[model samples]
Structures are given as structure tokens and as C-alpha cells.
Target: MSDANWKVAAERDLMSLGGRPRLFESGSGSYVTDDAGREHLDFLGGIAVNSLGHAHPVFVSAVAEQAAKLAHVSNLFASQPQLDLAARLKRLAGTGEDGRVFLANAGSEANETALKLARLHGNPRGKTAILSLAGAFHGRSIGALSITPKAAYQDPFAPLLPDTRTIEPTLDALEHAFAADDVAAIFIEPIQGEAGVRELPDGFLARARELTRRHDALLILDEVQTGSGRTGEWFAFQLPGMLPDGELPDAVTFAKAVGAGFPLGGLITFGRASDLFAPGMHNSTFGGNPLASHVADRVLAHVEDEGLLANVTRRGAQLREAVSALPGVSGTRGAGLLIGIALERPIAADVVAHALDGGLIVNAPAPDTIRIAPAFTVGDPEIEDFIRRFGDALNAASQSSETTA
Candidate 1:
């Protein structure tokens, strides 16, 4: 099939999710092939969804085996896979003592679950206002959108969940928000993925922890893009620079790559927040099905067994340094494999288009910043190839912009 044929059918059959023009037919490891058989180095990794990259044998095998045995059972019953996945996550989250897991199908739902849990935790005290960072991207749902802080996404919806506020991600700003005394929870992303892979300052996050503790409010960390060893650590909050002395959030939401391309997301709640949800509060039918839970378990095992976190740390440093040295590149930021390269000029869209044409897949999350979330399994060779192609793409896009100007 031709790209044109797929695109035409997509336009007729699918709603606009604002996707790339090309159609990908298959993927393996760190590369994807389009309908025309052109291969592209997929640095985006399905927007940080394919943690183990494409067609990973372990993940494929686990999902296939589980499906053959038992695919799904409603939440009305208990399953070992679901309990096993929750146990693994609880250990990874460092919330084993007093933590529980609420399984959902995606990052947005996980966050939504967290929000509801926080509200429930604070309902007795009349603390219902939710605060988040100004440049965060939580999700597209009405409740998530309320805290997301993007007007373009929120304005069309008009009237989102009430009392959701976005404050600048600063200690002083956080202090001010906490002073209100009615805040139920503060939703923060340890590293804002859609906001150009921006990292919240270590000091700011620490201050948030302190303030939320003092105010008796829940500190919810959205690690949808930063968890599952994507940031060299099990969770970005666990990064030494962020919270070295084993400090943990009240609740942390994770999804994205957890299922290794299958949809899976949930939250790890600690202390009092763990018991917030009662029997009839909230639930999802297909949240922790055996197939997804088993695949997630395999992904977790693959990361630990292969020691991919160390690779992410090494490759991330190497790639950041290489990309920073390129012309038209300003600087780089982010932890581990989640990196953002700032351009000297606002031509990221053009650069992304050029990179795509040159068999690369990168994202322009901001007008002047390009975000790269390669799979944890990416290697030095893939990093080097991306740098070479990205440099060329940047130059081509820059020159084209200059000529047009």
C-alpha cells in the first residue's frame, strides 16, 4: 500500500489527532518503516510509548502467552497478573509500606484517578482546589485539561473542572499557592515532557514536597513520560539530583511506556493517600487485564535484567553533548533519554519536517525546542546516527528558513 492510500483512508475514517502525514507500516528496535518501505530512525518512540522499542521479543512473547491463557477479566474479580504488576510498581515506587495501586488504561486516566483520589483525601477538610505548573501537559480530558495550563487545549472546551489553578513552577510561587490553605493537591511533572522536555528545578520540587507536607496536601507527581527507567531512574522523582534522601511523592502517576506499546497507566499512592479510594469510588473495566499486566511485567523485567537504566544515563549524556555541539543548537536539558535541544532560532517545526524527510523521527514540542525520547534500548550507534542526520536536517531547515526570509 502507498502512503497516499493510507493517508486518504485515515482522513476519511479517523478523527484528527494532529498526527504526522506519513503512514508507518512496521517497526523493530529503534527504527520504523513507512508504507513505501522507507526506514526512519524513530527517536520519538511513539511519543515515549514504546519503551523497549518495536517488536521486542520479550514483550511480544509475554503478551501473546498471557492472551492465550487469559486475556481479560473484569475488576469484579482478582487476577494474579494485575496483583503482580501492582506489586512490581509499588516496589519500584518505594511505596511498599503503605501504598496501593489504581490501574488505568493511559496516562490521562491515571492522572484523573490521582486527582479524584486527592480530592477524596481532602474532602473532609474542604481542600478541593488543585494546583499544577504553568507549562505542564497532563492530558486532554476535561479534568486533566483544567490543570494542563494550555489555553489552546482548554479554551475550546470552556468551563473545565472548577478551582484548578496553574502556578509558575517556583518555590516562591508554590509557597504562595499553598498559603491559600484550601488546596487539595499539587500536580507536578518532575520533568515536563510536552513542555519541551523541561526539568523542574530540584529545589522547586523539594520545596513542593515540603510545602505540601506542611499544608496537609497531597503532592502528586505526573511521571507518565519520566517513569519506567526512561530517566535512568525507575522514576524521575527518584533521581539523586531531584530528591537524593529517599523523598517520595504522596502519589505518582505512570503510564506511557509501562505497557511497552500496549495501553496501561496507574498511580502509586503512599501513606494516607493510599487508602483514599473506597470500594465504590472509581474503577476501570480493562485497566489491569492479564495481557497488559503481563506485558508490563516483562517490560519491567527487561529493563532491570538488561540494565537499561545505565544505558539511558550514558547514552543521554553522550547524545546531549553531541547535539549541543551542532551549529544552530543553543543548549540541552532533561534527565537521561528524555532530552530537549534548544535551537538558536525558532524553526523547530521546519527542522522536524526536514528530519522526517531525511528518515528521522523527532518532535518539536516548542517553537524553539526539539524533544527526543528514544527507547531505553537505544545504543551509541543509534545516537550517533541521529546526531548526524539531525545536524544535516537542522542545517537544511535553517538554510531554507533564511532563504525564505
Candidate 2:
């Protein structure tokens, strides 16, 4: 609220890399303003959370109106919004008749709920192992962290969930792991987020689904960063699978875009697995509350009405092509707006800082990979602006790299 408060945040309460973060006061469509009154074009879209961008009239009204009416109601009595949101998500998640939904607060919480469901579904049998892909980033919590591939985060918190295993995400590797008898679930992100937006080899998901089925393991798709039209498709796996089985993942874990920046996560389950959890098996007091549910409902409705899926397809390719043609940029990988640019020079951090300095907000998750996850509402003008500025920043970074080398 105050600069003093922002200054205090830098000193205490912030975790590592947490201090000195942007002190923003407000945001509008594809833009945010700092406490200092500096406005920056929001290309990052809160790391793929603000699908409609900050303070969209619809989103603002939804939050404001919902806040005024009923903010939160526990899971005891039925809330229409909660049920409606669940029904919408269940349908979207491909859960059809046997579908069930579980709500949580964030990506990690959602994945944790999925893990519990897997364990519960495998109740009659002993299935503990969760096979995760390499270079994965599920979330910050222990359960999700256990399956994540980044050792830098995991090494500090030694003794994560045992029976957790990692594989190369190759067909043979996945088959080998699924050959085991005790695997409860195989968790994967359709597009690995913190792992630099790496897409799994084509058909990997379909293959994993089949392998999991054969081994009685659940195929969990962690679409926290990949869902809600980020990948142009309703879900990334919808693209006809190149995998042997060509099937859908059994469970879908969604978070980032579910509530359109309101912090909602849900798990969609299919098959008889939906019956695994009974009364008190699992619950979240704040989960499926009225406010979040309303927002979730509106977000989905808005996505469809606004034709964001088609826009994501068009603009994502434009952004990718523009970045690829820029000097010092080698290539781009990823589907839709969830793109990662591979810079010829390892100046991604410098480019990010420069882009921010140039009134653009983008981030680099690795030394050479710059991620561009703009809001789905990003228009033609903003996309062009981002490319022009981003290319300039990349040029500047390249020049600096040349000087340094």
C-alpha cells in the first residue's frame, strides 16, 4: 500500500529471490503499474495467470460483485457456484459420466490432491511410486516438489516422498517404470514450465496413458501452466497424440488460469477412481468457495465467448515467428502463448531486465531460455510492440555479450 511497506517487504518476510520484487499497485489490460507510478506492458501476464489481463471489466466486476455478495462458504452446504464450476471443469477435463472434481488453493495444492486421489483410488492395492519426468517443475510444496526435476530446489529439502522416481520421459523409460507393480501415478506437465517450457516429444502423453493403464497407474496431467487456452487448445493433449495409445491422461490438475488470477486449483478424475474418496477422505475449507467459483465460471465463459482459443493460436505463432526472426534468436519452442525462445547468446537475464526497463515485462527462467507467456487477451498491437522491444533488448544483450566475451 505504501512505499515504506514495499521497502519493508524487501527486508523481511520475503523468501530468497523474493526481495526487491516489483512493487505494483494496479493493473489493466496487458499492463501493470508500479508503486512508483511506472506502467509496463505486461507481456508475462503474471506468468500465465492473467488470461484476460489485469482488471478486465468482466474480471473486475466478477470479483467485485462476488465479493459484495458472498465471498466464502464452506463445503458443507451446497453452493450453486461451486457445483456449476465443478460441472464446467468436469466437462472440460474430459471426465464425462464418472468425473469428480477436487478443489484447492494453488498448483501445488491441486497436484497434492491428485496424488491423494491416486493413493486412495489404489486403496485395495499397494501403489506408492509416482513416476515424474526429468526437468519438471510441479510446485513449491513437498509432494509436488518431490516429483519436480530441479535438484537445486529438492536437494535442500532432502528426504522427499520416497518411492518417487524420475525418468527421461522417453517411451522406453516410461515403459520400464510402468512395468513396476507399485506405481500409483505418473505425473507430467504437458509443457514443463520451470524446465524451460520444454514440450514432451510427440505422442509421449498418449503413450504414458496406455502404459499407466497397463500397470494400473493413473496418468496425471499437470496442466497448471498449460491449461485454460494457454496452448491454443482447450488442453495441450487434445492435439492428436503421437503416442502409441493416443489417449487422454486419466486426471487433469489445473491451477494458474482456472480462476483467472484468483488462485483456484482443481483436480478432475475419471473412471471408478472418482469413487475412491468418500466423506472426509479429502477436503479444503477454502476450496470451491463462492467467490473463486464464480470467477472460474466467468473465466471459462469469457474464454469461449471471446474466442481466445483461436486468438491464442494466431498470436502465438506470430509471436514465435517474430522472436525467431530477431537477430541473436535461434528458435522458439512450445504451443500457443506458452513459448520459450532459445537465444543464440546466453543473455536471457539481461534481455529480461532490459525488456522490463524498456516498459515491457518478460522473464527468463534459464540462462538461454526466455519465456513469453502473455495474456490471452493480448491484441495485435501489443504483440507487435512486444516483438519490436524484445528484439531490441535481445540485440542489446547480444552486443553486451560480445563486449564481455
Candidate 3:
């Protein structure tokens, strides 16, 4: 079908999330060709999912080979690829020998699994309350959304899973919440991506670890956006000073780049938490199918073999240093390639539109914050292109703002 026709049909049939969507035809490396045949740099990386960028040989080969060999076998059966992927994730997460994995199809499902774990851990002791920070975004599913704490996302789904509370992300607030000794689990994103890439305060995570340990509450880190080396390290919680030297969260949820554009997600439990879920507690038909598992295994292997984590660190620093000097940029936050550019004025949406017009792809997660999450494979050339195009967009936005003022 023609691109215009596709857009028309989408508008007629699809649910309205925002404005009309842009139709993208294909992609290679760090760029995508839109329906209009314009090659635009994909700095957003499908919201940080395309770790190796679009159509990488490793991703293509794994999908094809795995699909040809074997695909689905219900949870009643296990595949080698599934087992291998689970073992790899456990190692990367530093879950040691006791760690267990529950696979799912997306970030929301991964979080739902974690929520179930919380219930299992809390129910026996009559501790049923779940805690989350303000401005957090877990997922749209009812269980995940209950802890998300966003008004617009939660209001319509009134009468959500009760006993879910939103707290300010401060040690005092956290301490007070657990004072009742009825807290089940506390969900946190080491770096809250939907809240404009905001980072938790220094030492907050370590203190959380201490508190959750004292109260016997599960500390679940949502690495759905920051996992699989998007943040330079394998996981954001693994970053320096995120926690005490030998400490780890009770569970961690992962998705996004772990599949490198394919649909796969999971929750990894550490220590005694791994034994929380008994057999028959949860299952997914396509969660750990050979097709998705093999492809995800290959994506992670490619990231490790290619040293893309180092690339993410270096390229992210370069991009931040360059973009911070641009005309309208007030500052930059976030670690590695998951960057949020703060603007001097609330013109991030205007700047994003201008950037798209200039053949760059970015998005505004907030009125004054522009988010850029390019592929982990990004290097000098991509960084240079981003700086040039993004700078032009900033300049254009500045000019438009001045004219309006």
C-alpha cells in the first residue's frame, strides 16, 4: 500500500494515542527511510530498543536461523536457546547461582511478573502495600499501571489494584512508608526514563537497599529502559555507587534493547527471591520461544563482542559535550546514550518537530526535555551528524521562540 493510504487507514482504524503517525519504510544502521523516502537519523533508536541499530546482520541472521530451526514450545517444554538466554541474563545481572528468570513478551509483562512476585512475598505476612515513586511510568497493563503513579494514565482506570501508593523519592519518605511494616515491595527505575530521564539522588539506591532489607520488602529495579547496556553498564543498578559494593536488588525487570527490536522481556530474581514463585504460578506461551530467545541471545552477544557498551559510554559523552553547547540547550542529564537534553525554554516539542524536518529523529518526553537514545553502535560519524542536525533544530526553535516573544 502507498504510504499515504497506510496513514489514512491507520487514522481510520487505529486507536488515537497522539497525532497522525509517520510511516517509516525501512532502516539500516542508524537511519530510517520514511514513507516520503527521506533518510532520517534515528537518534531515538525506537525509544532505546534497537541496540545494534536497524537491520544489523547479527539481528537479521539470528531471526532467520532460529525461525528456520525451531520457534515455539510451550512452557511445558524447554528449548536450548531459552535456557541459554536465561543463563546469560543471570550472569549479566550478577544474580549468581540462585537467580531465576521468568520470561515474558514485553516490558509491561515483565513488570507484571515482578508484581506477582511482590504479592507472593508479601501475602504470607499480611504485607500487601506496594510503593513507587512519583512521576514513574511502569507500563499500561493494570498491574503495572497501578504502581505507575501518573494521573492521566491512571485516572481513567479508576479502582486500580488497591494498596499501591506513590511516594516522593526521598529517603525520609521511603523510611516513613515502611514504618508501618506492611509494605510489600518498592519498585524503582534507577533512572526514571519517562520522567524526562531523571536520575535518583546519589545514595538513594543504597539506602533503599538497606531499608527494604530491614523491612524484608522486595526492592525491584525496573531496568526495562536502562538494561542491556543502554546505560554503558549492563544495567543501571550496576553503575558505580548505585548500591553497596556487594548488595543487589531482590529482583530486576528487563526489556527494550534485550531483544534488539524483537519482543522479549523478563524478570530476574536474586537470592531467596528466586524461590518465591512456585510451578504453575505463571506462564507465557511465546515468552521464551526459540525464535525470540535465540535472537535476544545473539543481540546481547553482538553487543558484548562488538564492545558497544564502551561505544555507548564514549559516544554518549561526546554527544552530551557537543549538544550542551548548542544554542537553546540549558544542560543535559542521563548516563551513556540515554540522554535528556534540558532546554532553556519550554520549546522541546517545537525543537523536536524542527529536528524531524532537518532529517533527525528525537522526542520530547517533557515540555522542556528532549530525549535522545541512539543505538549503542553509534560512533563519531553519527555523533557529528546528530550535533549538526540537532544544533540546527535548536537554532530554529530559538529563532521561532524569539519571534513569538
Candidate 4:
């Protein structure tokens, strides 16, 4: 069938989220081939989920082997892979022996699990308020959405979980919110991915840590977009200067790259936070199943073994440096392989469309920001290809803007 036919069928059959999506037949490494047989460089990396890129040997092998051996045993049973992954996630989060893990199906589920933890901790003390930054994007579930603070995404689903508030991302705002002593927890993204990859103000995290600790509230860092070595660290909270030495968040939610495109997510809790969830309090039938657990564990191992974190750091710097020199570019934000290109004009959508036409894939999270979160395995070749294609796209967008003007 023709690409046009596929698109027409998609429009007819699929729900209209943002219109019909581009039809891609396959992908390998840093590129995806559309149904029309055009290969596009995948700089978005499935929104930072494809850690080793598409169809990595390690990822495929793990999935196949685990499926053949064992896939689903439900939550009632425990598997080696499940236990191993839990231990590994605890280590990665620096949660020590007191840490515990709750596996789930996606970022939304992970955040929901974190929400339950907050309730478990707060209900006894009559603390029910939940705080999130103004521009934060946690997830779309009712519980997660309540803390996300986006009007467009939340307004449609009115009467959300109560007592949720969006506050400014400032020290004073945090202080004011907690002064009431009603906040059960505060959800923060080390780097706000949906808010155009905006990082929190310097020292904001450490200060939040102090405030939450003082108020006896849980500090949950949503690392769904920045975890699994995306920020050149095991977790964003572990990044240098993100938190003081020997300091840690009460709990951390993770997904995306940890599964390397597999539908897997989890919440890791530290210290007393780990003990809050009683066994019967929460559960998922498919969570921590053998297949997803094995695959996620292997993905994390591959990222560590292949030294992809270093690659993320190095390639991120290179991509930012090259992109900054391009026409129409104002600057770049984000760390490691997750980056947001700021445009001189609010033409990021046009640039993204041009980039797609030029056989490169990117997304405009905001009017003036183009987000690029390529595979952690990207190296010089991928970087060079991206520069060449993206440069052409920028030039074309600039020319079109001039013509329109």
C-alpha cells in the first residue's frame, strides 16, 4: 500500500490526538525508514525512550531470550529478572539497602505509584496537598495530571485529584507553600522535558530537598525523561551539584529509556519512603513481569557496558555546539543527549516540519524550542549526519521566513 493510503487509513481508524502521525515501517540504530522508503535521522529517540536506538542487538536478544524462557507470571510470582532489576534500580538511584522498587507499565503508572506513596505518608498527619512547578508535565493519568499543572491537558479532565497546586519554581514559593504544612509531597522534574527542556534554577533542587525534609513531605523527582543515563549520569539527581554530597530524594520515579522502548517504568524509594507502601496497598498484574524486567535490566546493563553515558555527554556537547552556529538558532538548553534548540523566532514548528522533509526527525515542544533526544549510542557519524541535514533544514526555514516577511 502507498504511504498516502496508510495515512488515510490511520486518520479513519485512529483517534485524533494531533492528527495522523507519520508512518514508519522500521528503524535501526539512529534512523527510521518511513513507509515511503525514506530514512530519517531519529533525533527524538522516541521521546528519549530508545536508549540504544532502534533494533539494537542487545535489546533484541534479551527480549527474544526472555520471551522464550518466561514472559508473564503475574505479580503473585517473583522471577530472577524482576529481583535483579529491582536491585539494579535501587543501586542506580543511590537508594542503598533500604530502597525498594515498584514496577509499572509506563511513566504515568510510575508517577501514580509515587502519588500513592505520598498519600500513604501524608494521610496519617492530615497533610493532603501536593505541589508541582507551574510548567511541569508529570503524566496524563488523573493522579499524575493533578500534579502536572498544564491547563490544556488538565482542563478537559476536570474534577481531578483534589488538593493539588502548581507553584512557581522558586525558593520563596516553595517556602510559602510548605508553611501551611499541608503539602504531602512535591513532584519535580530535574529538567522539565515538556516545558521545552527547561532545567530548574541552579540550587533549586537542593533547596527543595531541605524544605521537603523540614516539612516531613516526600520529595519525588520524576526522572522519566532524564533517567537511565540520559543526562550522562545513572539518574539526573546524581548529576554533579544537583544535590549535595550524601543527599538524596525521598523517592524517584523512572521510565522511558530504562526500558529502551519497552513498556516499563518504576518507582524507587529511599529510606523511610521505601517502607511506606504496604504489600496490599498497591499492585499491578503485569508490573515486574519477567519479559519487561529482563529487557529493562538488559537495557540498563547495555547502557553501562557500552559506555553510552559518556557518548551521551560527548555527543550532546557536539550537537549543541554545531546547532548553535546554525542560522535561526538562538541557543540550546538541556544536558547530555536531551537538548532543546532555541530559535531566534517562534518558528520551531516550521523548522521541525522542514527537518522532517529533509529526512531528519525532531519536535517542537514549545513555539520557539526544538527538542532533540537522540540515541545514547550516537557518535561522530550520527552527529555529522544530523548537522548536515539540520543545517539544511534551518537554512530552508530561514529562507522561507524571509520570503514570507
lDDT of the candidates, in the order given: 0.90, 0.83, 0.93, 0.92
- lDDT score for candidate 4 against the true structure: 0.92
What candidate 2 gets wrong by more than 4 Å, as runs, is: 1-5, 13-17, 242-246
TM-score, per-candidate, Cα-based: 0.98, 0.95, 0.98, 0.98
* Model 1 / residue 216 / CA error / Å: 0.7
Model 3 segments more than 4 A misplaced = 1-3
Candidate 1 on 4-118: residue-level lDDT in tens?
A: 7778888899998887578888999999998888999999988988989999998889988998999888889888999899999999889977899988899999989988987
Error of 2 at 282 (Å): 0.6
Q: Which candidate is the best by lDDT?
A: 3
User: After aligning candidate 2 to the native by TM-score, how far in Å is the CA of 105 from where it should be?
Assistant: 1.1
Candidate 1, clashing residue pairs? none
lDDT comparing candidate 3 with the true structure: 0.93
Better of 2 and 3 by TM-score: 3
Q: Is candidate 2 or candidate 4 better by lDDT?
A: 4
Q: What does candidate 4 score on TM?
A: 0.98
Residue-wise lDDT of candidate 2 within 251-313, one digit each (tens)?
888888767789898888877667778898788889989999999889988998889999999
- lDDT by residue for model 3 over 1-405, one digit each (tens)? 686799789889989887755788899999999888889999999998999999999999999999899998787899999999999999999999999988899999999999999999999989999999998989999999999988899999888998999999888898899899999999999999999999998899999898898998999999999999999999999999899899999999999999999999999999989999888899898899889999999999888888889999998999999999887789999999999999999999999999999999999999999999999988889999999999999899989989999
Model 1 poorest ten-residue lDDT run: 239-248
